[model samples]
Target chain A: MSERALVIERLNKIFTTPNERVVALREIDLQVKQGEFITVIGPSGCGKSTLLKIVAGLDVEYDGKVELNGQQIKGPSLEKGFIFQEPRLFPWLTVEKNIAGDQSLKDPKVRGKVHELIRLVKLEGFEKAYPKELSGGMAQRVSIARALLRKPDILLLDEPFGALDAFTRSHMQEVLLNIWETNKTTMIFVTHDLDEAVFLGQRVVIMNPRPGHIKSVLPIELSFPRKRSSLAFQEMRRTVLNEFEKVEEESYTVGAGI
Target chain B: MTVEISEKLSEPQKKKINWLNVTYPWIVPIVIVIAWQLVGSLGFVEEHILPTPSKILTTFGTLLGNGELFYHLTVSGQRVLLGFALGVGVGVLLGVMTGFSRLAQEVIDPSLQMLRTVPLLALIPLFILWFGVGEFGKVFMISIGAFFPVYVNFFLGIRLVDQKLIEVSEILQFSFWGKLTKVIIPSALPNILLGIRLALGTSWLVLVVGEMMGTSAGIGYMIQDARAYAQTDIVFVGLVMFALLGKCSDSLVYAIERKSLKWRDTFKG
Candidate 1:
């Protein structure tokens, strides 16, 4: 019913070396609606991150089409925000400055926006603290705030909480959900964690490696603030897990045959 | 009970340790000065060969009172400051140019590296011949000396900027100038500061050589003039001035380093 925010059709990516050419992704077609939250999950070497990178226009050497709102993706733009696995906060910049980033903090509007984002990320007291001074989780939160400051059309997160501890990772997930609810921006989250996939995504895209492609898309009919302990939540998670395991077993067997 | 007693004893001992930490660096220099004074006063060494510490102190007082020392210090300071400024400006410009452009790096870097290999003092005769034995020649020599360290460090710094950060800049849609000022320069600041420190040290060294050759003013000139009159105490005073000034300049840069690089999570020790 909603307008399409992104359309990826017959997308393929290849990495070539002097020795060999490897297929990173193949025939990856997906459609995302405006304000939709999609989680892509797969095993290692799945090229899920590569897919996100392609969509962000950081990797332009791909076949087929990735159109964002009817325009072909050419290169990285302010409209597409990307959060890498690492926090990657500029060490010299304070929390406020990192969020403000290239935008002059001298402007009252910019300062207010940075402050609001900081508060949104629950980093209220760390405006003056440099990246090195903040904890790992705090640094990542600053990065999230920084990405949100640009008010991008779509935010692609590549396992942004992969390095965090279980507790912090869960907390960050909630924080991310809160940001998504407030902004209502389209999000395509890539993760290896099944719990994360089932928890955050309106739809979970299960990917298979060895010429990575989408195996299936499972839409969650569950409500917001879905409990991990709930029977319905467990059933959905189990279904995605089964799909994920099937791909893994198939890839393993294929490798063995090779 | 024994633990409590040990803790009570350690409290005063901790205070003593703090006092020792403050005084530790000065102890050796003070002891050496005292011994040197003792030897000089006993006439163990000829005054002409090695003047007494008290005699050197007296010369220092005379130089200070007559304002000659201040004048010479000012001359040397001016030359170093001017030359260092010129050197830093040119070095940073070239460094930035070569850093951002591969074409610039390829065209300029190899030639610069070749030039850097030559001992800069060897250029003094050529400088004298080209610019004459004027203040220009001396300043030129000091500037050349200051240039290489800065150029090398800044170039290396720029090249060493993290690739991930560059991607972040790209993602932010930073304009060329924005990327340079916001990302590149700030990332390379530690190296640039290091280059500055090295350049400052080299500037002083070149200043001594420069003044010793042609200049009739400055601490180096004062030393040369004293040598002619066999005023060994005055020579010692010049040496002392050089030492003090060098240390002072180094400390200034160190203070800048401390202030600017507070964000670095480096080992304190």
Candidate 2:
């Protein structure tokens, strides 16, 4: 068995307003192994993004424990790379400079690494292009390259392709799978797309809202480059969809009783 | 065959368009000048009341020939440079401090805002009493005029930096200095540049008012002296010089802005 990269034990998160305390996550427990790809799929208000934020140490105000390699998660570090929905590329910086970030590009090693990541993300001949000059898809690719520049222990993506069009979204999914194959870095992707969850994740963790807890974990027993139109792919997608349907029916019944 | 012919014709056509682009801005000013010269030549207005373009040009030429214009220009230019530097330096420093530290903003911003509202011209009497019509008093007045715009814009720019980018900085584990230099400053650059342009114009206005009172070597002094002698042509010459210098400074800052803010995707029109 691969060593555990991240462990969450009875994690609970609440957001307090002036009038009320909202439970964003409840009794959530999951473990991610090193080099494993985990996709968390949930509807809006499911707290999947909140869960990722906590793990990334952007939100440390949570109950229970989130340990990365036996160390309690405290605050953001270079070890945990985060990719938000938007590319978040610095407008002033060129593609190469954005990847290099605060690290001086005058160093040959840093320059070489930036070039390598640029190629890895397939942004050739665009090293000098600013964020404004690039397309939405290209900007997001640059963002992915930036996240991988530090060679982080884990990368957390919060619906990184949610803003992209359907065609670009699928293309980006394939690109992400290629990066995962090459780097073998642990990734925890949070998305609402069923096809995306099944297409990339080795294990899909389905989540439900209204208190926000994991409904079930479905392991995808499939090979790489899984065809979207194939029977098995459709079957797995249907299973995940059925999980959501069951949750909806139960919630409706509870509503009727009330 | 048609494509080749069109390409050959477009060569001169492109040049014509470029020429028009360069000359269009001068059309209105040139027309006004010609009409004014016609009016003067036809005796529609006295030269003392409204000096003819030809009369102003001759006066300008005499001043240039004797090196008087150059000397006055240099004197006023030097004062503007010193005062502008002092104002911009202090404004940016305090702006950055208040931008980063909430406590500094709380302690200093209200006082600065109150001072900003105070009429700068009304302080001339107080400045004269304190610094006594010397170089210091004029420079101080100019500096005070240049300070407020830069300070306000820079403070607002820093405050308006995108919170998302700040989160990106946190994730990258940027140090305080790193965040300020890499994220904060670059993001605030557009507003800062705008502030600088406004401050430059204010500096010139204040310089004219300052020179009108105190020292007797600047362009403003020359105009005041011309007024005393009823030499309207020399006064027109001084006014023209001010207009030319203001336009030149504005163009310089505009070029800097274009170079620095090339990354902004905005509507050019």
Q: Among these predicted structures, which one has the highest DockQ?
A: 2
Q: How well is each residue in B1-269 modelled by candidate 2, as lDDT tens digits?
A: 43553355345425544787889999999999999999999999998999999889999999999999999999999999999988998899898889888999999999999999999999999998999989999888888878888999899999999999999989998888888878998999999999999999999999999999867799999999999999999999999999999999999999999888878889978
Q: Which stretches of candidate 1 lie over 4 Å from their true place?
A: A256-258, B1-24
Candidate 2 deviant stretches above 4 angstroms: A252-258, B1-17
Interface RMSD of 1: 10.2
Chain A TM-scores of each predicted structure, in the order given, are 0.98, 0.97
Write model 1 residue lDDT over B1-269, tens digit each, in one string.
43553355345325544676879989999999999999988989999999988999999999999999999999999999999999988998898889878999999999999998999988888888899889888887788888888988888899999999999989988888878887888889899989999998999999999999877899999999999999999999999999998999898988888877777889979
lDDT, candidate 2, A154-181, per-residue tens: 9999999999999999999999999999
Report the C-alpha lDDT of model 1 over A1-258, residue by residue, as the tens digit. Answer: 399999999999999999999999999999999999999999888899999999999999999989998999999998899999998988988889998889999999999999999889988767877787678898999998999999999999999999999999999999999999999999999998999999999999999988899999999889999899999999998888888889989999889335
Q: Give each prediction's DockQ, rounded to 2 decimals.
A: 0.32, 0.44
Report how closely model 1 matches the true complex, as a DockQ value. Answer: 0.32
Model 2 residue A81 lDDT score: 95
DockQ, cand. 2: 0.44
User: What's the alpha carbon RMSD for model 1?
Assistant: 5.4
